[model samples]
Target chain A: MVSRRGFLQGGAIGVAGSAIGATSGSLVANALNNTAAETATAKRQLPFYGKHQMGIETPIQAVTNLVAFDLKPETDRSSMLRWMTLLTDDIARLSRGEPVLADPAPELAIGPAGFSAYVGLGKSMFIKLGMESDIPAGFIDLPAFKMDQLEEKFSGGDVVIHVAADDPIALSHATRSLVRDSIPFASVRWTQSGFAHTPGVVKSGVTHRNLMGQIDGTANPQLNSDDFASVVWMDQGPEWAVGGTQMVFRRIAMQLDTWDQLGTKSKEEVIGRKLASGAPLTGTLETDAPDFAARLPNGLSVIPDFAHIRRAAPEAFKERIFRRPFSYEAGISESGSVDVGLLWCSYQANIEEQFLPIQRRLEEFDLLNKWTVPVGSATFFIPKGPEPDSVIAQALFS
Target chain B: MKKIAVLLASVLLLAGCAPAGQVEISDAWVKSGEMSVEGGMTAVYGTITNNTDKEVTFVGGETAIAGLVEVHEMAMIDGEMKMQRIEGGLVIPAGESAVLEPGGNHLMLMQLTGDLMAGDMISVKFDFEGADSITLDSVMAKPAEGGDESYHETEMDMSN
Candidate 1:
């Protein structure tokens, strides 16, 4: 097997870094700014320094790249410390529209482009670093569901870096920069690219449409609200995970060619929502609560018993989770079918409590499962953001 | 990947024929490579060509592998995708072939009496709109092989 150290020792990092930077010239703003703006929607910068990571609760950007890395076999705690220190600085400098250490083509850094990077450690990292005790409760691998057709290439990793920006090129450049810097200690395992509606494409607060053309993410708790904090952040855990949350990422493959044959009425019955508007079967608006008790003129329930919304509905207030999903298209397959799917991501205080029950219900009997398959799945513990002088997860090393 | 390939193979079978001037059934095959741990659920694929000048409807069918065999269609409806029992029978237009394959239209064999292994033979029969009922014997074949294609092939090239 070719190790990451071997790949970097050949002295090709500079070439890779420069190529990434060279491709983003058109995406960066022509003029540069010296002062940073404070608004979340500001074009130039998103504050990287914070109590919690900026990427988690900050407004979702237009583009995202989720990349996973496996640590080299020789990597140790000391190597991890060095890696984190460099990564934290790189994140800070890039967020400020500055180049990372030894950036071959520094010009690309001039446009932060609303960039933000969130880092997390996968379960295997704890065992690899000999810090298994630090693995927080509810951080284990998710129990396999009935519909999972997980592919090895997309599943597990030792660490993950989620990079997002308003510009696709900017996102690509930053992701390349990070991978280049970690070349000696880690190797890329998988990378999933996705996009959302461009900023201002729709009303500011409207839920985004998934590839399936359904209004998704309609019930997420408002950012920075008390409910958000309660549902997403961990109040108590290992010292390093105090404010951190657990993230569940599942790559769900949607079979659109087969799905295209269904009628509008059948589709509505499956999702329990109106096609034109995302309203429940018995409601008039998108946010209207679905009345599972309501019936039709024929004396049958309006929403079918197997409708997706009914199966995924939480019984109590605390069962909710914060969902941020992105749609991805790989390419056309040999069979002339398009490979499209959702990068279904969720953040919650505890995976066992908030996410599993919902997934179990969907697995048991959701009508929507017929055309969708879960092909990739993983779980990670995302550490909270750091102060200006401190590095992320700095406490774990102690 | 093997499961996907087998499912694709089941979809690719296009041969089917029946005696006389009616529907020709050919290329009949069953897929059973990797049934889910839940087990018992498998699919069959074949092509039904209408030989008559008029359209023929496939009323229903029965199989020895399971107690109940249903003609089901899988499709995305209004942003939601589902597979439901075809309310009426499947219609094959005159002189056209109705191909039942994975990810589209196919046979759903439920409540199996035994696990279908390689080399097993499944017997099934279908009733058409105007012709005599026909029985088909499909041999269970090995699952199709899946090629090793890197999942990251479509991303921007990363090689230095």
Candidate 2:
């Protein structure tokens, strides 16, 4: 199959190269001289999470939903450095468009800053390097995962790698691979892809959802171009991360069956925007600029006193998120219904800065909050780049 | 039965022979251009001519820029002037020139690459079935904020 990416590339750059050779390589070379996507190398080692990987694990519903890993507590400073390298490598490899690269390092993955330990041993300082070893297992929360099968074709054939390593380093290595490959990925992080639910999001099979369903991210940016950049990518980070963006993968399952049971007006209120274009209640069309000061036909605030979009954008922080999501369906058995929901993904700078505040406010009312709930969740940091750097590659056991 | 069959065949033939058309974007670049940051989705208007001998229909074209591109027919909707993406492509008759001007059947270049002050050409390819496929360089003009295409008639002649 002539891949959509390949087809588009045929129109976007294919014509250029053929035309370039016909004329002179000077023009083509000069145009690509500065582009990150045009100049980056093909493949590189994922710095972190190498030794811990048991290979890409797929979920039952034909969805490679869980990108899980094996991890242990950090022993010393040397272990920390090794873990950091793996973390950075994951980010590097991913940005380049060839994530599932074999050969990730063990000593370099995430066990040093693993958050699971916090849930188990309480606040112990010395046991298992401050990690809570007793916490239950988790995995990524997308339904209908298919390992090695490129799912969907919304933006051509962009892959979403859902990963959860024990430590930040491993997660980082996994993330880097996503970034380097330019493969659009989201990490909820705590759960393994294709694995059973981590006891939280059980109602997934009946309705579409996420951790906080209310149909989260009704106000996402368009993927027409890098329009997502302004809303998602952050500036002023580690120079390596300067060009990168942050991706927030939340497993929010909407209680659609329940949402359908709500009053029509009440349901509309949960999502501040309209069901059609996602425009503010005061307007229409997804791209419509909201008139915050305007009143409805009945004299009420067009966006209402408590709406998600208004709080999310707020004329002030003007913070927005670019969402590239897909629907997942995990079939437990041939007869039983499948676990279906959204692979809720968003990109932005500081998750705490932009996404959390909006979510916190929505969690307050969001009318749809009744049915929606957050289950297995993890936050993986994604760097911006079309390629990995030399500093990030490392051996699996290094 | 024979008469009905003849009538049906005639209708089917008419539908199939509907005019085929194409659009070409020449010397394209974004107007009101500004490089780097803080640029709005500009308007892309150009002259689209139905070059076929038969009266061709200029259907809709899609852009990678906006979430969705519509064939907008600007008119007063509910008291406020509004433009909507026509369900189908713009019907430009064969041998006639349909200038996709601002305030009319113009392309609303939403979610543009940047402030097009320095001349940015949005790559848009329009396919006209059997006739031909022409790619246009849509010039970006931010007629207004959000996604409205009603503008004070200003014509920037972008002729090939």
List candidate 2 stretches off by more than 4 Å.
Answer: A1-70, A74-219, A222-227, A263-266, A276-280, A330-340, A384-398, B1-160
Q: Which stretches of candidate 1 lie over 4 Å from their true place?
A: A1-44, B1-160
Error of 2 at A178 (Å): 11
What would the per-residue lDDT of candidate 1 be over residues A66-111, giving only the tens digit for each residue?
Answer: 9999999988776676567667767887787666544546577657
Looking at model 1, residue A85 earns an lDDT score of 62
For model 1, give the TM-score of chain B.
Answer: 0.71
Residue B129 deviation, candidate 2, in Å?
Answer: 62
> Which consecutive 10 residues in model 1 chain B have the weakest lDDT in total?
B151-160
Q: Given candidate 2, what's the lDDT at residue A356?
A: 63
Name the weakest run of 10 consecutive residues (lDDT summed) in model 1 chain A: A29-38
Model 2 alpha-carbon miss at residue B86, Å: 74
Q: Per-prediction DockQ, in order?
A: 0.01, 0.01
**Which lDDT value does model 1 have at B31?**
55
Docking class of 2: incorrect
User: Global CA lDDT of candidate 1, please?
Assistant: 0.74
DockQ for candidate 1, please give it: 0.01
